[model samples]
Structure formats: structure tokens, C-alpha cells
Target chain A: MIIDQNKIDETIKIIKANGGHGIQKCVQCGACSAICPGVKAGFPLLCRALIKDLLNGLLEENIENSSSWGCQACNRCTEVCPQGVRPQEVVFAFRRYQANELAFSTSAVTSQMNLYETGHAVFTDPKEARRKVGLPEETPTSAFNEAAQQEIRTLMDNSPMGELGLF
Target chain B: MEQIGLYLGCNIPLKNPDIEQSFRKIFPALDVQPVDLEGAGCCPAWGTAPSFDLNTWCAISSRNITIAEEKNVDIMTGCNSCFGVLSEAKHFLETPATRTAVNNSLAKINREYKGTSDIYHVAHVLHKKIGLTKIRENLKYKLDGLKIAVQTGCHTLWPSDVYKVKEDNPYFPTMLKELCEVTGATVCHYSRLEGCCGMGGMRSTDAEKSLKLFKEKLLSIKEETNADMIVTTCSSCFMQFDMSQPILKGRGVIDFEPIPTFYYTQLLALAMGFDPQQVACISQIDRNPIIAEIQSDTRRIKEGM
Candidate 1:
């Protein structure tokens, strides 16, 4: 596969801007892949391969690969990287790039909607549960407070995720 | 007594209020006051805002932290993912450029990110503020002779630099083990102690793959230790083990008897003599066996005294 230098430069720039400063420092020692849960779970590509692809601008071809979405972000990759590559940050950077430039998965979309609608990603009615536990029907969360929920809506509306139509 | 804002995140209050109750019950006993950070939204969740944009992540998380800052207290959470996103957001906002960008978004809601407060996982507060000796002295029912498998969860230990309180050895954390041991439970160590519970984004992304990862850890715990109960400091991990295990068992993915899971705070609340029905009752897996063990031990201790 031919490497696109422009794509590599663009990806690298975004990564560096997003606190992935150590991404360029990655030595491709495979330490991250060795401990990656995604790799261990039979994902063909992982932190090491992803970093190599990101640097080589080879990620465009493999953009739809489930491995990127499967990352648990466990940070074992970051913890073991000898060069301070912080591969997890790189994974998140790539994911952000994927969501904005490529396409995000359905689950990500649902989560964003959940956050936008209810101020929570996994909200359920807690009145019964709280009553069962002998606590007040409503705790100090956005579940019952309309004003706080409005604040979350405003924050989401003003942010990049909002611009992307994610929320 | 130092007071801290209790950031419940989303999952615990909605999906697992028992975990919330446990924190409420345990905090007062330890001389730590858990003030409610009212009108707090989600930590915005890592898989959601964080995966989309850094500034959005920071803005939403900073809004939650700002609630604690308003009350002049540090924020603490029982959810590891909450700690992960909030602490990492705080770390990003520490940089002047990121802080400026995030605060600009917060300004839309008439809020600002001061970056004044610290974020803590519940275990960190217990280990750092309550102290192991104090925890031991206050136990109403010691967990003597009970074997427990400890799941530290990935978020609590990872990116250790951003975290205010961390495991002494990030890879091989002893704080959760020490806290469990203080209640007289024998902390069982399994090979996959640091493994992910497949709880967060992974489960949302791919359920089968997530369960496979969880099954590997479960089999490891059963193979390596005779742990009577699984104790974790993270609410998501508690749901993964306590809630998901049965579904996996029903699907024939796992063959062993399901091990009940407890948040460490729930165990602490139980050991402090709170009724199991109130603080520990909402689990999918029955806690009767462990509760029986605890009750028998308490009876023996009282009779001997």
C-alpha cells in the first residue's frame, strides 16, 4: 500500500494537538500490542500496528476495522510503553479522527443522544431503586433537575461534538 | 472531618443505587462527609464526549468538577470511568491552551473551569483519608477467614500520572487489597488482577468480544483462587461481574458457579453492621451465602467477646 504523506502529517498534527505528544516517539517495540486487551481478544490490529499505520498514513484503508472501536482504553499500552508513547492517547486520537472524519459506530451515536437528552449516557428511573434503598426519591443528579439538564444541553451544543451533530 | 462532594456519575444512581447507598452509609462512619454536588450532570462518559473531541470532554467534565469547586470541596466518585474521564479532563485543562478552549465552551452555559478541585476514586479516599488502621478498628463484623477476589478495574490505576491518588505500584496495586484485608478478608490474588472487566465502551461496541474478555478473567479467578466473593472499587466492574455473569452462564459461555460481586464500599458498609437489605441488596446474584458467612462470623465474635 502506498503511504500518503499528507494524511500522515494531518493525523500526526491532530494527535499532537490532542496530548498525544509521545506518539511520534513510539519505537514500535510491540510492548503495547503484547498487553493490549483488544489484541488479546483476537483483534488483528492494535496499538503498535495502529501507531505504525498512523505514522505511515495507512489507517485510511483500515478505517472501518472493528479493532479501533473495540479498544477498552485499559491503558496497559500506555503503562508499558518504554518510550512514553502513551499509545492509549493515540488510540483515542485516532478514534476522534474516525468519528469526525470517517464514521462513528451506532453505539457512540446512541451514547451521545443519551447524554444530550438526559444528561447521562445510561440513565434509568432511580426513584424506585432509591426508595428500595431507603433514600430520597431524587439524589443530587440531573435525573430530576431540569435546570442542570439544560446546562448540559448548552455545553454539548457549544462543543465540537455538537458541531459534528453527534449530540 | 474533611468533606468531599460525591459525584455519582450516571450508572450507580440509575442502574445500581445500592452502590450509592453503600457510599452514603460508609462515608459517615469513616469521618468523611459526602456532600451532594447538586445539579451535576454526567461525567459525560469517556466513550461519548471524549471519543468525539477533547474540548467537549473537558468542558462537560469541568462543569461537573466546577459543581464541587462551587462548594469548596474535592469531588470523589465510586465509578472508575467517572474518575478516568474527570481526572483526565482536569489534566488536559491544566494546560493553558486546553483550559482556554474548554472554558470558552463552558462560558456558553455561564460556567467556567477553574481547575481548582481534585478527583478521587472511592478507594483512594478510603485508603488515603480513612486510613487502614481506622478502618480495621471500626469494623462491626470482621471479614475474618473470608477469601475475596479483588478487581482493581483499569481506570483507577491507569494513566497514573493524572490521578491524584494511585496504587503504590500502579501495575500491582495494594491499596484495594489492604483495604479488604483490614476487614479481615483474605485478599486473593489472581493472574488477571489488572485485567479489564469488559464493562465500558468495549461492551457497548461489541458484546460478544466483551463477554469473551470477561470470561477469561472470571475463569482465571475461579481457577486460581477460592474467593468467596468478588470485591471491586468500580461500579462498572461490579455490574460486569454481578450482572453479566448470569447472562453469560445462561448462554453457556461460562460453566462455573457465578461468584457474587460487591463494591468495596458495600462490603465495608456491611462490615460496619448496616443491614444487607439496605446497602447490598440490589445485586443480580444472591448475596445470601456471603451474608450468612458474615453473620456467622459476627455472632462468633460477639459471643467470644
Candidate 2:
């Protein structure tokens, strides 16, 4: 599944506009790669390499099966990034672009997509959910009751962020 | 006190009710109210859409926001995963570009998020509006003898701009420990206070890797702090600690209780003299030591008299 080089370009523009800097300032010091908690633990993380690939249009071939998905999004790279290019966000943005272009995204990504389709993420079968997750026979009324009485909810509704929807 | 609709996703209400009871007991004193927002389901977090289809996620998350708006109060969450998803959704609808796309998509459901209300975790409520002084004033039982390791769950700290606080370091356990200190507990300083639990998304995909990463941190706490309990502000982290610690022990990772993972609010309630059963729901755990410790404390206080 070759991602259009143009799609990668568009996501970079989106990420930069979203306040991510140093996307283009990469010196490829391997700082992001070396300091990455995932990379050090025998996980596949070409974080610095991936950013360079995207910038140089070298990601089209292996875009789908790339190891970028291994990123935990912990932003260790963002913290260590000498050039300020957030490899974490860049990789995510790239994945998002390529995922959109493909017919089938990764299983994890698709499962989450199914969540909105059914209002539940894990179980597609309703009866299975009840049997396995121990969902009650009722409509989970008590759970909502407890939620309604929590103090933080009231404070949240009343905050400025709550008002602006950035909460 | 004004009551806002509360959205207790999954873990807090069923798996961990101690925190729920604590919020019930304490918030009234803080002049804040909790409202019941019905028909609300999971915000889904990483479970929502890795595909990044903005419209579906917005509609589902906005549907949740709309429930709170309908109740005419803001939605509050105890789970960091819930807070992250709801907060991010709110951010999406507020931005002009994302808002337009989401609004155009959600037109099918007749639901639109006005970006009207805020979503908050309980820690923010205690530290901000409810102030430590007020909580300290109400404490009848001091946490003097208990050594607590405050675990600030990942979502509670990340994307720092959204969940702002007075911490010198976002990874620092200051806000949480300060709350514990107000109740007279000693907050042990530990390495990796800001480290990931590695359980959030990985639990569903790679349980072994997730448990392995989590076990390392759990063992570190026992070696570093020798603390009685591990306290946290997120439900996922709580579940990971409470369940993973014991399971990892069987796997030869550690040989301890994994320190009881109490919600910060529950610990506050315990310090305020709330009974363990009232403040801590027993059904949530497979261990008895947490309740046993509180009962023993009650006996000691009785004997002193």
C-alpha cells in the first residue's frame, strides 16, 4: 500500500499548523532514536529515520507496514529532539494520512473505528459483552447514578475550558 | 453547591467504587455538585478510533458532551482515559477547521458540540477550586503513619497545556502529594514518578509486554519506596497496579501486594475518617490488607483513648 507522496506532505502541513515545530529542522542526530524508550528495548523505532524519510519522500513504499506504530506517543523524542521536530506527532500524522488512503488500516485502528460504529470497542456481539464483561441485566442505571453525583463534573462544566470545549 | 452531570465511564463505578464514595462524601463540602448524566457510555479513548476519522469520534464524544449540556452542567470524569478523549473531542470542536469538518459529519446524528462546557478530572477539582487548605481543615484523621507513593497517571500529565496546574514539573507528584500531605501523609520521593504505566493501549494488544513494562515499575516502587500503597488518579493505572501486581508476582516479577492502588480521592476520604467500607469498596480487589490496615488503625485509635 503505497501512500501518495502528496498525502505525507499534506499531513506535515497539518502538524506544523497545529503548533508542532522542528518538523523540517531535523539534523538526524539519533537523539530521538537513542533516547526513545521503545527503541532502546528492542522495539522497532526508526523515529528519526522515519521523519527524514517523510521529508525526503522515502516513505511511500513501506508506509503501511512501517514500524512507526510501535511508538507509545510518550513524547520522549519530543523532549530529546534537538531540532524540536516532534517525531512522535509526525509519525502519528503520517500514519493517519496513510491510514486514510488505505482500504484496511491496522487491526488496532480498525477496532477503535468499530467502537463508534457500535458504541462499544471490544465486543461486537451484545450478548457476548453481557456474558463476558459481566454487564448487568439492567441498563447500568446505577453507574450513571454514581456519575451524576460526582463533584468534578460540576466543576468541569463551570470552568473556562469547559465553556470553550478545550476541556 | 451546584451539581454538574458526572460521567463515570466503566472502571470507577464498578471496579473501583472507593473513589466514587469519596467524591460523594467530600465534594459537598467544597461547594461543588455532582449530577447524574444518564445514557452516557464510554468515551472510548484509544479504543475510539485509531483510524482518526474525525466525524465518528466527534459525534460519539459530542453525544457525551451533549448529555452533560442537556443536564445544564459540565461533565466530569475520574478516569484519565475518559478525560483525555472527552477533552480532545472538545478541543476538536473548538478549532475552526476541525469543528467545521466534525459539524458537517455529525449533521447525520443531529448532534452538535457547542464546545460549551469543560471536562475535568477529580485532581483538578481538589487542587484548583477546592484548595488544599479547605481539605486540610476538614480532615479528622491524619495520614501521619502511612507512607504513600503518589502515581500521577500518564494522561493526567500529558499534552501539558490542556490540564494546567502549579507543578514545577508536570511529572512531579507535587499536587497529589500536597493533597496527601494536607491529610498528614508522607509522600515518598521515587524515581520514574513521571514514567508510563505501559498498560493503557498495550493491555488490549500485547498483555505480556504491557504487564512486563508495568511490573518493572511496580517492583521499583517496593525497592525504592518500601511504601505501603501506590496511589493514583486514573482508573486504568489503578486497574493495572491492583491486578497486575499480583499477577506479575506469580510470573516471578515481584513478591508483594503491589501496594494498594487507591484513587487519590479515596485516600483523602480515608484521611478524613471515612470508614474503609464507606470510602473503599471491597468488591474491587482480591486482597484484604487495605481494609485490614484501616480496621487496625481504627483499633489503635480506640486503644489510645
Candidate 3:
């Protein structure tokens, strides 16, 4: 990819706008990528690649990439990066950009919708499972309590996430 | 008794309540009380609130953290993702502007992010706050013959800057290994000891590829250690190690018999002589035989003496 200073500056602006404050600090040392599970698992545009792409002005263009969703949010990249780029934050920022455009990897949809409805990204009907182990059918969580679920839904609707009209 | 507001995230109390049961059983045995952080919701998790932006993520996580903050007890979660999301939320939410922003959102629900409470993963609580010497003293059963391959999990180690407790070195973690040793189970070393189990978002994205990644890690655990079972500190790792074994074998991903897996709390609960069914009944791999082996061996030793 040819260096487009225009594109680079634009990418940096958009990412910083979405909270990738350290996007420009990336030196492309590949240290973050070296230990990234998504990178090792064959997600092409994760740590180093995502940072490299964003720095090369590939923000909107890479919006559809599932690699951002592939991140475990383990923050291993942040720990290893010498530049303090916090590659995980950059990945999350790109995810935010994608989330804003509503161009999410299909796998992410259920969890987002679940979070909206249930307050938990990963939820299951707990009654049967909990009872089998002699636990209360209702876990003291938002999933069971109607008021708490409403509280969570209202909170999500009241934030920038609600601005996306995901609900 | 020291009290921790038990923040029950999605996986532990819902999908695998057995781990929650085990944790509850073990904490009291150590003279610590598990306080329920009732009406606690999600950490809002990464794929959900966090995928949008940090402000929204922190706002949502602050709901949970501030619940404990009000109670004046620190938060402890069995799920590493909860620990990761909540800790990172607490750390970043300390900024005045961010704190003010999220506090405004929180004011709707009458909860405030006071930044008074801290977050602890099960591993951190086990190794750092509650020492291993306490662990060894409380054990009624010894895992004399069992060998364990320990999965310390990624979130428990990295971004150590945000964590209240940390491994001396994240790369070569000894805390989980030492926690196992207190049960008298020999902790084995594997090449992929610190690698991801591919259980979290990666698995949610691509199941086959995620299993493939775990297969590589499982192979390392199987061959490098040839251990009796897999032990881990995170519930996600427990789900991956325990539930994936039979599926992997069925899919021809691995050629060996299934290795049972446990969260260290369950192992400690059993070592303290809790009923296996109450503490660890739910599993893909049968845990009954392992339970019998540990219990029977203990009973026989006591009888002999």
C-alpha cells in the first residue's frame, strides 16, 4: 500500500475520535502481533496489521474485517508493545468505528443484541442448569430481575451505543 | 471474616453454576465470606459495550463495580473477562473527565462510580490476597497421585498495569502452578502453558478454527506433560478445557482419550472434602472417577493410619 498522508491523517482522526488515542504511536515493530492469539489464529488484520492498516489510512476500508471482532481483549498486545500503542485499544477503536457503521461481523450481533436485551453478552436460560447443581434457579443477576434488565437496557440506550439505534 | 462482593458474570452462574457452587464452598472454608452483589449485570463484556467505545464500556462496567463500592467490599469474579473488563474499566474510569461522564450516565440508576473498590480475578485472589500457605493448611484431601497441566489464562496476567495483583513475570507464571501444588497435585510444564485456550471471542467468531487452536494447545498439554487432567484459574478456560475434549475427539481433532478439566476452586473444594456433585457435577468429561480416586485414596490413608 502506497503511503497516502491524506488517508493516514484521516484514519488517525477517525480512530482518535473513536478513542484510539495511541494510533499514531505505533512503530509497526510487530511485537504486539507476535503474541496475539487472533494473529496466531489467522485473523489477518489484528494487532500489527490493524495498526499498520489504520496508520496507512485504511480505517473505513477495513471496517468490515472480522479481525477486530476476533480479538480476545486479553490485552497481551498492550503488555508487550514497547510504543504504548495499546494495540487492543486500537482494535477496540476500529471495532467502535465498525459498530457505528453497523457493519459488524455476524458473530458479534448475537452478543450485542443479548447485551441489549439481557445485560450479558453471553447468556443462557439458567433455570435448568442452576437447579441441577442445587443452585437457585434465579441467579442474582440482571437476566432474572426484570427491573435490573430494564435498568441495563436503559443505561445502554442512554449511552453512545444507544445512538447507533442497535435496539 | 474478609468479605468480597461476588460478581457473578454470565458464564459462571448461568452456564456453569457448578463453578460458582465450588467457589462458594471454598471461600468459607478459607474463612472468607462471599457476599452477593445482587442485581449485578454483565461486565457488559468486550463484544458488547466495549466494542462501541471506552466511555460506554466504562459506564456499563461502573454499574457493577460501584455496586460493590457502595457495600465497601472489593469485587471478586471467577470469570477472567469480568476481571479484565472491570479492572480496565476501574483503571481508566479514574480519569476525571471519564469519571464525570460515566457518573452522569450512572446517576439515572442511582448508582455512582466512586472508584473506591478494586477488582480481583480468582487467580489473583488465590495467589496474592489469600496466600498458598493458607491453602495447604485447609486441605483435608491430598492429590498425591494426580498430575495437572495448568492453564493460567491470558487476562489474569497481561495489562498488569491495570491489575491490583500480578504474576512476578507474566511469561513464566508460578502462581497457578503453586496453587495446584498446595493440593499435592504435581503441576506439569507444557510448551503452550501461557497460550490462549481460544475460548472467548475467538471461539465465538470461528468455532472450527478456535477448536483447531485449542487442539494445538491441548496437544502440547497432552504430550509435553502427559498429565492426568487440565487445571485452570478461569471459568472460560475450564469450559474450553473440559467441554472441548469429547468434541475434539469426536471431530478427529485429537487421537487421545479425554482429559478432564477443573477450575482450581473445584479442586480445592474437593480437597476440602465437599461433595463432588454439589461442587463439580456439570461437565462434558466425567469427573466421578477422578473424584472417587481422590476421595477413596484419602479415606484409605486415614484408615491405614
| DockQ of each two-chain model | 0.76, 0.14, 0.80
Residues A73-163, model 1: lDDT tens digits:
7788888889999898898887887787747677677778888988898878889888998889887898788998899998888766677
Kindly report the docking quality category of candidate 2. incorrect
Candidate 3 off by > 4 Å:
B298-305
- Over 4 Å off, model 2: A1-37, A63-70, A75-86, A97-118, A122-167, B14-18, B164-166, B282-287, B295-305
Which residue pairs collide in model 1, if any? none
**How do the residues B187-251 of candidate 2 rate in per-residue lDDT, one tens digit apiece?**
88878677667666556545666766776677678788988777888877887887777787677
lDDT of 1 by residue, B1-305 (tens): 78999999998988788889989988888899999999888897877888878888888899999999989999999998899888888888888988998888888888887877899889989999889988876778877788999999888888788899877788799999999998888998899988888877778778888888999899999889968999999888988998788998899877877998899988888888888888888988989888877866543446333
Estimate TM-scores for all models.
0.96, 0.77, 0.97
TM-score of chain B of each: 0.96, 0.89, 0.96
Error of 2 at A49 (Å): 3.9
Would you list the clashing residue pairs of candidate 2? A22-A85, A148-B35, A148-B36, A153-B76, A157-B74, A162-B117, A162-B118, A167-B87
Give the distance in Å from residue B103's predicted Cα in candidate 1 to where it truly belongs. Answer: 1.6
Question: How does chain B of model 2 score on TM-score?
Answer: 0.89
Highest-lDDT candidate:
3
CA-based DockQ, model 1: 0.76
